[model samples]
Target chain A: GAGVSQSPSNKVTEKGKDVELRCDPISGHTALYWYRQSLGQGLEFLIYFQGNSAPDKSGLPSDRFSAERTGGSVSTLTIQRTQQEDSAVYLCASSAPGSNQPQHFGDGTRLSIL
Target chain B: ELKVEQNPLFLSMQEGKNYTIYCNYSTTSDRLYWYRQDPGKSLESLFVLLSNGAVKQEGRLMASLDTKARLSTLHITAAVHDLSATYFCAATQRAGGTSYGKLTFGQGTILTVHP
Candidate 1:
């Protein structure tokens, strides 16, 4: 893809249900990131992946949230047993090999927990 | 933990006016970035400040960074209605091996350039 791509641009689920958001990063890019943006708030870091390095998960809000990248091309963010507070926009971005490069962002998936 | 704070969380300005948005971080960092977002849209990268006294300008917007003070400023000159959007500043810090390239973002400043 010419740019970062995210799937299921919008998702709505009942509380306690699980949801999955997917991201397809730019080809050949080695760095990927996930962030959450609540209404009227700033972007909150969730996770980061740099090549084969174990993903940095220190920013994950809870154990219920986890992400995995397959083949270093596509990634998935799964929220288990969603809560109302989990409602937010999940954004994905990819950079060229390192953190020094500017990131290209996806349109993001807006998750709504009812 | 690197914490970032942005001032003037909400700004309503008349078009053609000049103003500045301020960002301050709690820790020392070498990289700073500015991004813009419209309502119901994704973020767009605007500028990257890599060193103290680094400055970058694009059209009506200019961004500057001061690593020593842990501060960054986004200055709007002769603002236009099309520039109405939320602006954010983020800082990158490498901590051990798990927090590399982790960007800490400050609360965004919602700017409305009114005619």
Candidate 2:
């Protein structure tokens, strides 16, 4: 695809189950970011990946949230023991060269915990 | 920590009307960004302001930055129904000349346009 891509556009999991969300950035784009948006709400930062370096995991809400980027391309965000509050849309975006550039986003994955 | 705030959480306007959205941040940043998100969709990049005096305009939207005030604004000119969406302002933290572009976003301004 010509733009950022995310997988499992919708997910419904048991309250205690775990879930993984995937992202594929645009080819050659070096920056990736993850964010969460509750229904009718704004986005909350999650994490960011620059090039192949260690990702900045600062925005992660808790220890149960983790993410990994391989070969500077694709990333996976994992959430453990999901709670009802984890219900939200997880968004992925990628930018070229620098972070100051415009970011192209993928259709977010809507996760619902029951 | 950087704190960002936006006002007029919701705005309803008719086509051809104009409005402005404000974004304020707590700390100094290297750049500011504006994005748009439609219903149940991901964000769409709208603008990037690199410096205090930076201003960028496209179509019906114009975005400006003021590092001194730690503020940014997105202005709409002759708005249309297609312009309805949630608008977000983001700031990037930087140390030295290099920045990782980890953006902290403000609560979005929701615009409703009726034609």
Runs of candidate 2 with Cα error greater than 4 angstroms are B95-97
Off by over 4 Å in 1: B95-100
Best by lDDT: 1
List DockQ, one per candidate, in order.
0.60, 0.69
What global local distance difference test value does model 2 have?
0.86
lDDT of 1 by residue, A16-103 (tens): 9999999999999888899999966558899888764545788799999999888878999999999999999999988885546877
Q: Output the number of the DockQ-best candidate.
A: 2
lDDT of each prediction vs. the true structure?
Answer: 0.89, 0.86
Which pairs clash in the backbone of model 2?
Answer: none
- What is the per-residue lDDT of model 2 for residues B14-110, given as tens digits with 9 covering 90 to 100? 9999899999999878689898988777788889898888999999999999999998999999999999899989887772245455678888889
Worst 10 residues of 2 chain A by lDDT: A50-59
Q: Model 1: which docking level applies? A: medium
The digit string of per-residue lDDT tens for model 1 on B1-115 reads: 8999999999999999999999999998888999999988899999989889999999999999999999999999999999999999999886454334778999999999999
- Judge candidate 1 at residue B79 and give its lDDT: 92
